[model samples]
Structure formats: C-alpha cells, structure tokens
Target: MRNFIILFKKEMKEGARSGKWVWLPIVLMVIGISQPLTNFYMPQILEMAGNLPEGAVIEIPMPSGEEVLIGTLSQYGTIGTLLFVLAMMNVISHERQTGALAFVMMRPVSAFQYMASKYVAQLCILLISLAASYILTWYYTNILFDHVAWTLMLASLAVYSLWIVFLVAVTLFVGTLLRSSGGIAGVSVVFLSVISLLTTLLPKYMEWSPGNLRAEASNILLEGEWGSSATLVSLSTLALSVLFFGLAVYMFKKFERFGE
Candidate 1:
C-alpha cells in the first residue's frame, strides 16, 4: 500500500510536469462548449455562411438539450479518446526503454503496484477532465435548450467514465506489451475502432462490450435510462479493466528484466 501511494504520487507529478493537467481538461471543455454554442447559433451561422437569397429563411429547429449533450459526448468519443490514448501510450514502454524500470524494480516495488499506480493516476486525470467538460456542457445546454436532469447527466458521466477507464487500461496494457509508443497508439486505435464498428453493426451481441458505453451514455442523456443491458455492460467493462491491468503487470514483470 505504501509503495502504491509513493508510485501514484510519482505518476501524478509526472502528469503535472507534462502539462496534461492543464491542456487535457481545456481540450475537453472546448469540445463540450462548442456543441451547445454551435447548436444554439446554427440559424445565424447558416445565414452568415450559406450564401442564400435574401428572402430565403432557414427554419432550423434547435436540438434538444439532451441531443446537444449527447453530441458533446460523441466529440469526446472520438477526439478525446484519441488524445487520452496518445498521451498515455508510452507510460510504461518509455520507462522500460529508458532503463528506468530497472532502477524502479531494484526497489521493493512490485509490478502490480507500479501498474496500478499508473492506471489510477491516469484514470484520475481522465475523470477530472471529463467531469469538468460535462459540467460545462450541462451549464451551456441549460442556457441554450431545456434543463437536463442533473442526476441523469451525472449518471451518464459515470457510465461513460467506465469506458474511458477501460481505454486507459488497454493503453497501459499495450504499452507494457509493446516497446514503441507509435505501435501502442496504432494498435490501440485500431482495436478501439474495430470494437466501435462491431458494436454499432451488431448491437445485440455487442451490447455488453465496453464500446457500448458511448451509446449507453447517449441513451441515458436522451431517455434518462440505460435499461438492464447497461448494468451488464458496465460490469463487463469493469472486469475487463481489472483483467487488462493484471495482464499489464504480468507482462511488465516478465519483460522488464530484459531492459537491464
């Protein structure tokens, strides 16, 4: 426990120094804010950009607050996910490449502790950034459209967070398995893309996949419920995260010795 705490703090400090603490939330906030603002001003924006006749009137219906919020989440599903995977792709691999893992291993720290610390620290940053972005989006959504239930929005955030956590676990696991950051990022992105495509194309069978979390998040926003399948998917995602973390630790323990 003490070793985990120490390593967790080290990871936090590394994140802070990397400017991830500042820029990641900022990027998410921008994505959140843009959705509502664009939806609210679509008519005016169209008038300015569309070169239509002077008498032609555009009557675009404003999207519901729920839709805007869901759109914001979709933005995170794409750009935010990519950013997180890219940022964390080298967490373990870089240490191994630099011979830092050898020095850390020489101490009393176990591989599980090391891997858990990285996962927890990265998960913390992801949650904080997503929370800030969601809150901002909710605020703007209320101003532009109808009020979204706070409880429902928060629940959606929690569900969606599980997906992000799963992504983090996968990133770390891939990092531990692969030495190159580019390889980690490429493989992670490809895996995520394939999962997303499969879930979308085969919702019945893939309902319990982590990739369904995004759809569940949108469903929660739009209908305030995710039904029975959400529970199954959430549990599966949580279990997968734990399994990935364990795999990462096992891989690190096996391969870290070769770094020396």
Candidate 2:
C-alpha cells in the first residue's frame, strides 16, 4: 500500500510535468461549453452563414438541455477518447524504453503495485476532467435550455465514468503489451471501435459489454429512467476493467526482463 501511494504520487507529478493536468480538462471543458452555446445560437449561426435570401425566415428548433448534454457526451466519446488514448499510450512503453521501469523495479515494488498506481493516477485525472466538463455542460445547458434533472445527470455521469475508466485500463493493457506508442494508440482505438460496432449491431446480446455504457448514460438523460440492465452492465464493465489491469500487471512483469 505504501509503495502504491508513492508510485501514484510519482505518476501524478509526471502528469503535471507533461501539462496533461491543464490541457486535458481545458479541452474537455471547451468541448462541453461549445455544445450548448452552439445549440442555443444555431439559428443565428445558420442565418449568418447560410446566405439565404433577404428577409427569408429560418426556423431552427432549439434542443432541450438533455439533448445538448448528450451531444456533448458524444464529442467525448470520439475526440475525448482519442485524446486520452494518445496521452496514455506511452505510459508503460516510454518507461521501459528509458529504463525508468528498471529503476523502479530495482526497489521492492511489485508489478501489481506499480500498475495499480499508474492506473489510479490516470483515473484521477480522467475523473477530474470529466467532472469539470460535465459540470460546465450542465450549467450551460440549464441556462440555454430546459433544466435537466440533477439526479439523472449525476447517475449518467457515474455510468459514463465507468466507461472511461474501462478505456483507460485498456490503454494500460496495450501499453504494457506493445513497444510502440503509435501501435498502442492504434490498437486501442481499433479495439474500442470494434466494441462499439458490436454493441450497436447487437445491443441485446452485448448488453453486458462496456460499449453499452455510453448509450446507457445518454438514455438516462433522454428518458430519465434507468434501464433494468444498468446494474449488470456496470458490474460487467467494472470487472472487465479490473481484469485488464491485472493483465497489464502480468504483461509488465513478463516484459520487464526484456527491458524493451
């Protein structure tokens, strides 16, 4: 536990030096704020850009706060996910390449402790960024559109957060298994894309998959009701994330001797 704490703090300091603490949250918050602002002013934006005939009326229906919030989440699903994968792709690989992992292993730290510390540090950053972005989105959504239920929003955030954590675990797993950051990023995106496709194509069969997490979160906002499978999905994703982390630990230990 002491080793985990020490390594976790080290990871946090590394993230700070990399500017991830500043840029990631800012980027996500910008994406969050932009959605509601754009939805609210879409009509005027179209009027200015559409080059419509003089005095021609354009009627654009304003989306509800729920819709705007869901749209913001979609942005996170794509661009935000990519950014996270790219940022974390080198977590293990770079350490291996630089002999940092060897230096750490020279101590009494276990592989599991090392892996868990990295995961927890990155997870903290992800949660903070998501919370900031979601809070800003919720605020703008309420001001620009109808009020979204606080309970539902919070519930959705919890579910979406699990999904993001699962992705981070996957990134760590790939980083441990692969030597190249580019390869890690590529495989991680493709793996997530495939999971998404499977869920979209077979929702009923893949209800237990983490891929359903994002849509389930959006549905909570849209319908204001939790799905019956919410518990099952949450449990399944959480288990999978742990499993991935364990795999990463094993892989890191196995590759440690290679010093790759």
Candidate 3:
C-alpha cells in the first residue's frame, strides 16, 4: 500500500510535467461553455433559416436550458472519451522507453503496483473531467432555465459517468498492451467504432450494452425520468469497466519490465 501511494504520487507528478493534466479540464470547460451558448442561440438560428412555405407550419419546441446543458454534455462527452484515450495512450509506453519503469521496478515496487497506480491516476483524471463538466452543465442550465431538477440532473450525470469509466478502462488496457501511443489510440478508436457498429446493427443487445448507456443517459436527461432498463444498462457498463480494467492489470504484469 505504501509502495502504491509512492508510485501514485510519482505518476501524478509525471502527469503534471507532461501537461496531460491540463487537457481534460480544458476540454471539459470548452464543452461546458459551448452547451449554453448553443442552446441560447439555436432558436434564433432556426428562425433565420425561415418558416415553412404556403399553408405549411412547423412548430419546433425550444430546448430548455436543461436540455441545452444535457445536449452539451451528451454531444461532447461522447467525443471527449477519445481525448482521454489519446491523452493516456502513452502512460506505460513512455515509462518503458525512458527507463523510468526500470528504476522504479529496481525498488520495492512490484509490477502490479506500478500498473494499478497508472490505472488509478487515469481514473482520477477521468472522474475529475466528467464531474467538472457535469457540475458546470448544471450551473449554466440553472442560469438560463431558472427552474431545474438538481437531483435528477446530477443523478443522470452520475449514471452517464460509467460510460466514461468503461472507455478509460479499455484505453488503459490498450495502452498497457500496445507498444506505441499511436497504436494504442488507433486500436481504441477501431474497437470503439466496431462496438458502436455492432450495437446499432444488432439492436437486440441494446438493452444491456455499454454503447447504449450514453444515449440512454441522454434520453433520461431529456425526459427527466429514470427507466429501469436504463438502470440495467448502467449496471452492464459498470461491469464491463471492472472487467476491462482487470484485464489491463493482467496485461501489465505480462509485459517485460524495462531492463528485465
């Protein structure tokens, strides 16, 4: 445990020096700001596109501030998963290349402790980004909408956070297994795209699939209701995250440490 804590601090310091620590928060803030701004202007943009011709009429419901906030979260949050993957792709690769892992492994630290510390560090970054974005979403929505369901909105974000976890787990697994950052990022993108395609083509699996979890969260946010099916989806995502992260740990052990 002491070794893990020491390694964790080392990982955190490397993260700061690498400038990776700044990227997630910047990405989150950008998405957070874009949400309310777009929501505030969407109606005007639509109106400028002009009304229907002749007797035809169109009535588009204006998105509430909550809807805007949810939109921003869901829209950019999905894309933001890739940022986590890309940013963390080199966590182990760099250590191996730089001989840093050799120096650490020469000490009392075991490979598992090294791997687990990296996992925890990346997980912390992911949670921080998601929590910051969601909280900002709620704040901005409240500013624009005036009336908001704080509990439900925050609950919805918590549920959606599982998808971000799953994404990070898979990316960490890839980073540990692959030899290069580009390889890690490429494999992650391909894997996620394939998972997305399979889920869409085989809609039967949608009920308990991680791919559906994000979209389900969006629906819950928009409708302001928590369906039992959505809860099941969240459970499945959590399970997958645990399973994948466990696999990452196992893979990290299999790798020959630097200088070994």
Q: Which stretches of candidate 1 lie over 4 Å from their true place?
A: 258-260
Clashes of each: 0, 0, 0
Q: How well is each residue in 1-260 modelled by candidate 1, as lDDT tens digits?
A: 99999999999999999898999999889988999999888889989997799799999888899998899889989998898898888788778788987789889888888889999999999899999999999999999899999998999999999988899988988888788999999999989889889999998898789998988888888778767878999999999998988888888878775333
Q: Decide which is better by lDDT, 1 or 2.
A: 2
Q: Which residue pairs does candidate 2 place in steric collision?
A: none
Alpha-carbon shift of residue 232 in model 1 (angstroms): 1.0
lDDT of 3 by residue, 80-129 (tens): 76777777888878887899867777887676777778878878877787
lDDT of every model, 2 decimals: 0.89, 0.89, 0.76
RMSD of each: 1.7, 1.8, 3.4
How does residue 211 of candidate 2 score in lDDT? 87
As a whole number from 0 to 100, the lDDT of residue 21 in candidate 2 is 95
